[model samples]
Target chain A: MIPGYITTNAPALLIAVPLLGAFLSPLIGKISRDARALWVLAVMTLTALIGYFVAFLVYTEGTLLYVFGATNATLAVPPDSGGIPIRIIFTLDAMSALMVTIAVTVGFAVILYSLTSDARRSGLEAYYTIFLLMIGAILGMVSTGDLFNFFVFLEISSLASAGLVAYKVEKGRAVEAGLKYLLVSTIGGIFFLFAIGILYGQYNALNMAMLADMIQWTPLDKLALVLVVAALAAKCGAVPMHFWTPDAYSMAPSAVTAMLVVASQASLYGLFRICFTLYGITLNYVTIGWVIIILGILSMIIGVTMAIPQKDIKRLMAYHAVSQTGYMLLGVGVGLAVLGDQALLNSYGMTAMEGGIFHIFNHAMYKGLLFLTAGAIIYQVGTSDLNRMGGLGHRMKWTMIFFIIGALAIAGIPPFNGFASKFLIYESVFAFSPLLSIIAMVVSILTLASFVKVFHSVFMGPPLPGNEQVREAPRTMLIGMTILAAIVIISGIFPEFFVQNLITPAAHALTDQAGYISAVLGGA
Target chain B: MRMSKIVRFGADVLFGAIVIFGLYVIMHGHLTPGGGFQGGAVVATGAALVIVAYSYEEVIGMIKKTILMAQESAGLVMFAGVALIAIGLGTTFFFNFLANSGSLFGMTVPFGPNPGELNTGGVLPLMNIAVGIEVWGGLAIVILYMLSGIGKTKEA
Candidate 1:
């Protein structure tokens, strides 16, 4: 039997361990750099273990609720509180579990990659601290069932990521990009807070489940929804508000850019949680659904078209990040559009949602791998410009292989994870609307074309002057890329297994509003 | 870049008083309106006054950046450590284990309004102190670094 403490406290431990380790990083750095690196690794490993353990428990037992500051961890509503859950609660269902798994997995790989890749950098203590804090913030944002708590975590992530983005201060452009990111995110955060305030003023509750239980779809609530959707859409780099994304992603350290993909997905998760759980079918589902779908289409079309002409390789990948986010939005948006109709929801809406949720996982893995490969190229070749790179396939064989895997997976080729999710999306979404599906297919083609150009320019030609002596990426960086590469390949080949086991459950958790509400407020 | 001697003397005189008041606010955070963040900012304001009054060279001599960074880290570790201790006691994280247990900061009071007691909040006061220290260190270091950067720009 699992120890009772471990089983009961895994949710808290998952976030707290990284937070503690983050602060302790600088102190440990004082002792020795190697010691600090090992400490960070140990902390991330423990966090990942606890995260997977929690996911396992959530899958087997259904939604798990842990009430902070309570005598019993699972006691969400104390007898004295008169049927109200007053304490901050963590409500982990399959969806949250999935997001947590993605975060910890990517976080662990990024830190491992950074260990050797950034060994020579100065002020590494601060770098590792902010990275751990970002991980902890993402974990907290996904798991918490409190709106206020979610806001707190969102701000923490925004600030920590901004610091990471600005870490390369010697590069004036990096500082400028970080500033833009900071300004945009701060505005988004403030809008989110305003929405939270509106909801609190109406319902007098900060807990997500409680607010959902009491939500009345009043004008104030509608306003709150608008504010929330806009803020989170911006935060997640959807369409018109995606100006800061390319700059930030291109300028940040490669490992951070990879983790930033997961960070933005956390915001996307919050957007879904608010719409599905907070509003449910009470509000106007069709309109909101179409809004997200339109955003997705715009992102897909514009993000790729813009990416095709970029000379900087990382900037091009950053645009792809925006493009991939569109696929997820489209998938879930279709599900939302059909939320009110039971017949339609059961027939294709569920599949669309699964496709979208599965895409979140696949996109994180492949895109993370792609960014790390780009980082590897930069590490060996000393530049991110495609024009300045060539024939790296000879010297950097492992990196070339990793980059090819990422490129193939991202282009939706068969026997890769991206195709499986996109296939689900296309089949289901075509049943919903063929035009949207066609747009999506065209976007995929553009994506493939862009990556093909990038691959040829960066690796296929004769070695350019000053690039002939390029070498393979460091062992740890390759190890990091390999972890994600392995996942992309394995999940691609076994898509059905992951879809049936993890994605289906997570999709159900997203749409099953009554089950989510009852888990926290109705049950013990 | 030094201020007038009179201004420096006044800054020194007010620093201790400001810190003491800030500590008072942090200690009584659970019962009063002020809390760790506010109190810490107040203390940092005092540090900023001192930083402004002295030259960067003299300021570096008086207050080291490494020590401030350590202080900030220690404060956060302590805060997280206190929360984690609850897990060791076989309860969930952030559990108010000491509340009414007659341990450190463990005093129970009757509900519905009475004269406030500083010792009744269980771990909140300790959390307040931890945050106060952290904010004090964090805000002060930011000011110090900014000033140092300004100094470098001037020299260049």
Candidate 2:
């Protein structure tokens, strides 16, 4: 039972440590204000350690699986399968393990940063409780193998994130936004549930691997596939289903807002898993790609256009979130459209997909950094309105520096993480389709323009009405932003390293539907 | 905080029925049309029923912000808990571990031929129940907060 020493089984401690910490947070919070936050940080630190170790195990030892109930008897077929039957399965390939590492790292940073921000002293113990739950749910979502189990985790992540948005009950707008997010997110969750139901009904199994074996090109299967993709799109804030993003981000506490940004990115990973694995990618997945492409293009145009007029900084970032999603999806969509056609998929489409997936991690780093920086500014200046913020660079030098790097990274400037991913998408798209490449280029340039405006208005101009006495953010916030800023820079410089290791595995995971399905349920 | 005993009794019965039905739905998810989320929505009806029958202030005071928040968060964590076990076991995300026919409390039960059968799947029932609690508690808290927030707001 010494699982850590066993190459085939990862230590369950990675998830246990954080979850157990979450359960004890309330009780510990009563003892000291910082106790719960520090406990969470410690838990995530442990989670990251375990995640990194597990990832190292998977990388060195190959794919590792642990059946829930420890069955001594093996299944009829499929080597490395369950022993005693009726056990929850945990399978870690490189991709899932990597994501766990990223999520845990970012989560730790966020919790640490919040400890020093006004979020700590805000008498929002319940808020931290939900925050920890969210981190745990995301960890669960990324790491689990059961499809039904995945849906449940999705709901947990969604609810906790929405709760974070409404943490400030005094802001009636936040409450309203939470409600809207709930309604839409609930619908998404329901659709996901329905898709699970459909898969179970037709396949007579909820195991992803077993279900994939049972899948055939039937109308019912197509419908289930559509429902799953649609539901995921809503969660990812794809266009038409993306109405909730701006309000939810604008209304929540800044710490919560930063967390939600990362949470949403994590959900996109789910979308990729469901679409590619649950429904075999070889079958008409390309059609869905067209749909996603259309949505992505629409979001890019509309999100930037909308951002041009925003007065509030968070709201603008909110629109940009949508626009950025478009950029990510552009590569994904292109890869999907060409998946069935080997010629198109080979040269650049694969690279494009890698670009999109790479951008997911890069976006998480830069966007989370930017949002935290925004939170820092709001912490000091007490406003997220761009028109109201001026000369903040002089008052909050570290915060401003972090914000500049984040803005540069987000705007796809050279020598930044954003540019690295955007370049992949750009070059790959040009090789595949000039028109799509043109659109992507336009989006990139506009992104730069938008952040420039943010810089000029928020950081460059004369000190605004109330910023005369605005002080710098606390050291904890600086640490979080600094960590992300360094990551962004490293990713930018080591694009090849990231693509070869992290992005390629993620892209391959998304593309290798058979591998994903077989790994989860067993070989068909 | 005072209300007629009859009114209070009626609300209690209604809530009791809804709670029971929601639990049944959640537990029977593997075998039936209803699952955790649907059952959770049904449970929230009990909260709504209580809100409608009682004074808003009383209902709000009884539930309390911290408790509601805790319930919502706990439910979320519970759902994640099942997945955490799977992660620890080195299975794929959300892999069901406890899905089998085993003797529990000296009762021998048969899980049907398919893994999809009720009581056959591993951890699904538990996950479903966790989701049920989350959906029930989360929706209720969200709605209550919204209603009270809106009720007190003045038009600009």
Candidate 3:
């Protein structure tokens, strides 16, 4: 079949449209501040609506590919027949669609919240523009089928995020944190480039689907695999490479910081995409799983241990971000390990993988809510320092309540979203390794303890000297927190809905090599 | 002051050679060793050399700030445009339209999907060049911004 313009490639538009919109924004912003914000918001809202339509199209049409420019019609190819993908390839599958849904919905909520708060409103035009680009980039990263395209989108998101982190140049550590983040992300980018070069050299192909079929695990292939995994681990803030995360989170403007944390999550998605979709997990090396599990364990221990000593509320939460990532990776890693065992693979392994992916959505909600609440506190009391704050429950009742809800959810309390996923992980891990389960439980307990310190210092102690003037966060911030809080609870109550509709399909697609290859090459 | 001039002259020649070499590499990406990223970085070095050799204001004037910005945006647009066109061509996005194995300029230059004329393959080489331009322009802009900040401080 010759491709036509009306092909099912709607996913590519979700990215291209917003990218075009981003370039138009600063010019539009130059006209008037309000005009700029409105334009960006309009574009974002439109992009979100388009994203919804794409998701709908995916469900209705099944797998669809949007070729950016032009393509050859050949279904199956002789050797050296297909050329490099010169255009952007947005391939929409169950996994990509799910990620796009989360990104756009959360993005909409964040933009709406920004409108109500004056703190973020002053830098309004630049904020919305960058925010929109971030949304577009993440959506593109998830949907793109080409390997080089993935790296381009990665750089777009990564660099834009670095700029946002340093946006608050007046803040003492903001620029320093941004610089450190830049250095590490640059290194990560180089690792990705090296991997890409090796893979390209081996197969002479950059398309994920094609590469999946062509890739044979030669010594060079193994080297590329190691490099790619290491790079992604750094991006995911997996232990040891996670040093820059807390500082970057602590320094960026609250709204930006809240949005930027999702970068690491998307990068984790990148890792899963490459490992399962590109590498086909059945290959006999247990090293990948072992390495991932070790990193997960270290992240859990170190993240929680570091959190125990943090006096700054933001820094503590950042550490928790690292720790929580451990749970997510542990689930996925356990799933990988158990794949060779039949009963375990289906009942426990898939369960663990689903748990990890579900936790991605869960963390986005609870952790984002936590950061927004922290932003609210900082807005009111002008400090994220835990030791300096006291008795904030009296003044900022709603903020404290929301914070508690988020904290509880993150602590994996029953009846919250976190617990539902945590339970799956615990059951899976316990079946595999009881010792790992124990450590996971210990990390959860310590997470709760760390949040308790935040609660006691910020909301329990007597109001600090000269702190009486602090007031509740504005309605906008409240709305942001409320939306995330509601989702956290709703997801907790209705785990099956999310699992059935989103998590299961995505997990299946992640592990489905035949499905991916057939979609790209017409048939295996 | 004279030493600065000598350093500037050396930097200028080095940067020029790098820029030319980078383009040479990118143009032959499909057949040979070099590609967009390497070439683009070299192009960015040319911009950096200017900053070192002359006043920031003077360099900005020579390149034209708007032109630099336009270059960045245009590269992105071109890259996307190539991909979109590939879709229209009845295949996946970014499908290479002009990949062949051929020799050019006394050198055997591989060009398309099959070894043929320069235009035989799809649009890959074009995309590579576009990406090269974007990388060069974007990095230049960033470095210029940082350098401008330094320029401001020196005067103050």
DockQ of each: 0.89, 0.14, 0.29
For model 1, how big is the iRMS in angstroms?
0.6
Candidate 3 lDDT over B1-156, as tens digits, reads: 112878878877897687888887777665566677778877888888778777887787777756666666677778777766656655555565444434222324454575443442335567768878878887888888888865667767
- lDDT, residue A121, model 3: 36
Q: Considering only N, C-alpha and C atoms within 3 Å, which residue pairs clash in candidate 1?
A: none
Best candidate per TM-score, number?
A: 1
DockQ of 1: 0.89
Model 2, span B1-156: residue lDDT tens: 335789888998888898999999998886789899999999888887787667677888777766755666577678767766665555543555665436311123454564443445557778788888778877888778666643334322
Highest lDDT: give the candidate number.
1
Query: After superposing candidate 1, which stretches have Cα over 4 Å from the reference?
Result: B110-115, B149-156
Task: Name the weakest run of 10 consecutive residues (lDDT summed) in model 3 chain B.
Answer: B100-109
A1-524 per-residue lDDT for model 1 (tens digits)? 77999889989988899999999999999999899999999999999999999999999999999888787898988888988889999999999999999999999899999998878889898999999999999999999999999999999999999999989875599899999999989999999999999999888899999998999999999999999999899889999999999999999999999999999999999999999999999979999999999999999999999999999999999999999999999999999999999999999999999999999999999999999999989988889999999988888999889888898888899899999999999999999999999999999999999999999999998999999888889899999999999999999999999999999999999998889999999843
Error of 2 at A236 (Å): 0.5
lDDT of candidate 1 vs native? 0.93
Name the docking class for model 3. Answer: acceptable
The chain A TM-scores for the candidates, taken one by one, are 0.99, 0.94, 0.94
